[model samples]
Structure formats: C-alpha cells, structure tokens
Target: MEKFTRLTSVAAPLAEADVDTDIIFPARFLLLLDKAGLGKHLFHERRHRRDGGMTDFVLNTPPFNEARILVADANFGSGSSREQAVWALADFGIRCVIAPSFGEIFFSNCFKNGVLPIVITGEAHANVMAAARTGQPFTVDLEAQTVLLPNGPALSFDIDPWRKRALLLGLDEIGGILADDAEDISAFEARHRVDNPWLFLDDGRMEQLLSQGDGK
Candidate 1:
C-alpha cells in the first residue's frame, strides 16, 4: 500500500446518497483477479452508455476525470462488502473520499487499501460539497487531519489513530501487525513450537514417522 500523507488535486462532486458498492464498481467486473487497470472499470455502469459509449457522468467529464478527491453525500459507500470498491477508487487515483457517512465494511476497507474515507457533517460537509463542484484543487493533509478548501477555510476530520498511522506509514492491516507486533508474534511462535513439538518436526522426525507406518 502507498502512503497517503497528503493530496492536493481536483475533486469531483457526486451529491447522490447511498451510492453503494455496485454503483462504484459493478459486480460483473468483480471477476477481475488483477488490480491493474481497474480504474477504467470504476463506475463502469455510470461512465458507459447502453451502446457502450461514454456518458456525461461527472467522472467522465473534464477535470473530474483526474480527480484525486471525491466529495459525496451521506452513505457514500453502502451495500454488500466488497474491497474492490476501494480498489477501484485507489486505482482511479482518488486518495480520499469525503462523505457524511459510509458503509461500515467499506469504511474499514478504505484504510486497508490506502484510501481515506472521511466523515464530516453540518456546514463543513456542505462547504466541501460546494467546493467540489468547482473542480478546483483542494489539499488534504493527513498528518494535519484537515482539508484546505479551494478558497481558504480549512476543515478538520477525525480518524482512528491506528488507522491514521497505518496510512501515513503505507502499511496494510497485516503489515501493520508485523511492524508493530513482530516480537510478540515471534515469541508466541517459539512458545507454540515448544508446547507442540510434533507440529514442527524436523526431517529426521518426519522419516521416523514415515517408517513407523509399519506399526500402523
């Protein structure tokens, strides 16, 4: 995973609520085993027309096409659990998603996949949505936990400290565990091996077991 310390780039506004995982990345494309080129499949249904042409969707238009931040309404990523939704966003170069709320699963998946899903409300969220409409640059400072809008005002958002640390250090969940608890994990494995010696048998032990098949 890549570090998401900060981003200053175009933001696209998608004011719709309950956008859902399917809308973000169609299920049919879920068959894709590779993460590469998933960007072209992001919002596949919305970006394509019935005849397989490009629609006038916000993401297909100028400036928005290169968006690094996505400003959306409440419940931005709802529906079934699909980590691919976050994958699509990341592949599309969107580092952050600003929404009033997000699906519980999607929210967690974002952090694991190097995408920041921020929750904001009240006037601040309204201001963000308004700023996104302009297709101008907005700066998101992960270390500062603030978003500097196009004009001037900066808004702060909250994130779990551990998740924030992982994002800053470019560590996924397993990577975080190894980085933080490698010693503890090693100690546990050592104890387990001593307690269950048969589970870690050497070549000599394996040969003995194989030869003992005569006693079966």
Candidate 2:
C-alpha cells in the first residue's frame, strides 16, 4: 500500500446518491481476487449500454476519465458491503472520494485498501463538485485540514485524527496491529512454547525453528 499524505488532482463529480457497491463494481467482475484489472470493470454495467455503446456516466467524460479524486453526493456507498467497491475505485485511479456521507462498511473498507473516503459538509461538497465539473483541479491537504480549489478560496473540512494517521502511513487494520508490536510478537511466541509444553507436541521443535532463522 502507498502512503497518502496529500492528494492534488482533478476531482470528477459522480453526483449521485445511494451509489451502491454493485454499481461501483458489478458482481460479474468479482471473479478475480486480484484488483489489478478491476479498473476497467468499475461501473461496468452503467458505463456500457445494452447495445454495447458508452452510456452517459460521468466517468465516461474525458476530463473525468483520468480523475484521481471523486466528488460524490450523500450515501455514496450504500448497498452491499463488498470490499471490491473500494478495490475497483482505487484500481481505477481514484485516490480519494469526497462525500457528505458513506455506507459504514464501505467507509471502513476504503481505509483498509488505501482509499481515503473523505466526509465533508454538503455546502463544501457542492463547492468542490462545482469546481471539478468546471475542469479545475483541487488540492486536498490532509495535514492542513483544507481543500484548495482552483481559482477559488480554500474549503475547510474535518477528519478524525486516527483515520488521518492510517491514511498517511498507509496502515490498514492488520498493518497497524503488526507494526504496533512486532517485537512483542516474538517474545510472546517464545513464552508460549515454554508455558504450554503440550501445545507444541514435539519437544525442542519451537526452539529449533527459532534458531534456524532471524527472530523476526
């Protein structure tokens, strides 16, 4: 996962509510666990018509096609709690998504996958979307608690300190846990074998394993 200190780029407006995970990445494309090729499948159903032509989706536009930041409306990720929604968005080059609200499960999934789900006020969101639609680039400064819009004043927003740290360091729940006590893990494993001899059925098995490689 890549560190996400700050992101400055053109933000495309998706301007829709209750945009669920299934619409973000249709179930048909979930065949592959690896998210690398999922970008092409992002909004798979909506982007293409029954006649096999491009639809009127916001992402189909040229300016929004290469957008890195997405400005969307309330209840951004509402329906199913599929992790693939975050994967598809991140893989599609959308690093951050600004919305007034987000589905609980989808919000958590975003952080775990290195996508910053920014919750902003409705008024501020409108301002950002207007700028984005006009082809202006904006800067989201996580450290400064501000979003700078092109040719306009900066917009202030709030973000939880803990979430900010996770995004900045690119540390997911598992990554944070492991980084917090890597040394303690080694010590605990050593003590576990000694305290519960029967747990390690083979005698000296644990010690031999420890001696064969670096403790880490």
Candidate 3:
C-alpha cells in the first residue's frame, strides 16, 4: 500500500448517498480475480448504459477522470463488505474519500488498504461537492486534516490520531508493527524462543513468528 501523506489532484464529486459496493464495482467484474483494469469498471453501471453507451458519469467527467479525492454523500459504501470496493477505488487512483458517513466494514477496509475515508460535516460535504462541479483540482492534506476547496474556505475534518498518522505515513497494519515496536518485537521473540523451545518447529520458525505477529 502506498503512503497518503498529502494529495493535491482533481476531486470527483459523487453526491449520491447509499452507494453500495455493487454500484462501485458490479458483481460481473468481481469474477475476474485480478485487481488490474478494474478502474475502468469502477462504477460500471453508472458509467455505461444498457445499450452499451456512455452516460457521462461523475468519474467520466473531464479532469475528474484523474481525480484522487472523492467527495460523496452519506452512507457511502453501504451494502456489502466486499474488499473489491476498496480495490476498485485504489486501483482507480482514489486515495481519499470524503463523506458525511460510511459503512463500518467499508471504513475498516479502506484503512487496511491505505485509503483514507474522511468523515466531514454534512454542510462541508455539500460545499465540497458543489465546488467539484467546477472540475478543478483540490488538495487533501492528511497532516493538516484539511480539505482545500476551490472557491470556498478550507474544510476541517476529524480522523483518529492513529489513523491520521497511519495514512500520513502510509503505515498499514504491518507497517505499524515494524514502526511501533521493532526492537521490542525482536527482543520478545528471542526471549520466547529461549523460554519455549518447543515452539520452533524448523528453519521456518522466524518466518512463522513474523507471520503470527502480522495476524495480530
């Protein structure tokens, strides 16, 4: 997962609420096991028509096609707990999603994959969506916890200090372990192996311990 310290790019405005995983990445696309080329399928139904035409979806707009930040309404990613929703967004180069609310499962999945799902006030969300209509670039500063608008004042948001630090430093779960207590971890493993000799099976003992630490 890439770090998301600070981002300044075109922001795609998806004002619709209750955007389920199916709408973000349809079930048909999930049949393919690869995460590649899914960006073209991100919002497949909304971007294409039944007659195999285009419907001018939010993501298909001019500069919005390259948007890194997404401004959306409440209950974003509400339906299923499919990890593909996060995959599609990240594959499409969307680093952050700003909304009034988000599905619990989807929110956790975002952090695990290094995506920042920012929760802002309803009024601020509306303001950002309205500004996105200009199709101009916006900035999301994770360190500052501010969303820079085009024609309006900067919008402030709250992210858990830990998650904010994680996103800013691009530290997913594994990264956190290495950063938070590398020495302590090494020392513990040494002590544990000395105290519990039976735990080590063979040459893969260290690898097994590292994997077990990651599972936490």
Off by over 4 Å in 2: 197-216
Error of 3 at 21 (Å): 1.0
Residue 205 displacement (Å), model 3: 15
TM-score for each of the candidates: 0.91, 0.86, 0.86
State the displacement of the C-alpha of residue 123, model 1, in Å, after optimal TM-score superposition: 1.2
lDDT at 180 for candidate 1? Answer: 97
- Indicate the residue-level lDDT of 187 in model 3: 99
Q: What residue pairs clash in candidate 1, if any at all?
A: none
In order, candidate lDDTs are 0.92, 0.85, 0.86
Q: For candidate 1, give the lDDT.
A: 0.92
Considering lDDT, which of the candidate structures 1 and 3 is the better prediction for this target?
Answer: 1
Indicate whether candidate 1 or candidate 3 has the larger TM-score.
1
- On TM-score, the leading prediction is 1
Residue by residue across 4-50, what tens digits does model 1's lDDT show? 89899889999999999999999998999788889899999899988
Predicted candidate 3 versus true structure: per-residue lDDT over 1-216, tens digit per residue: 688877888788887889989898888877877877777788998888899988898788778888888988899998888889999999999989988999999999899888899998757777888887777888888888898887778888888887777777778888987888999999999999999997766868777877989994
Candidate 1: regions farther than 4 A off:
204-216
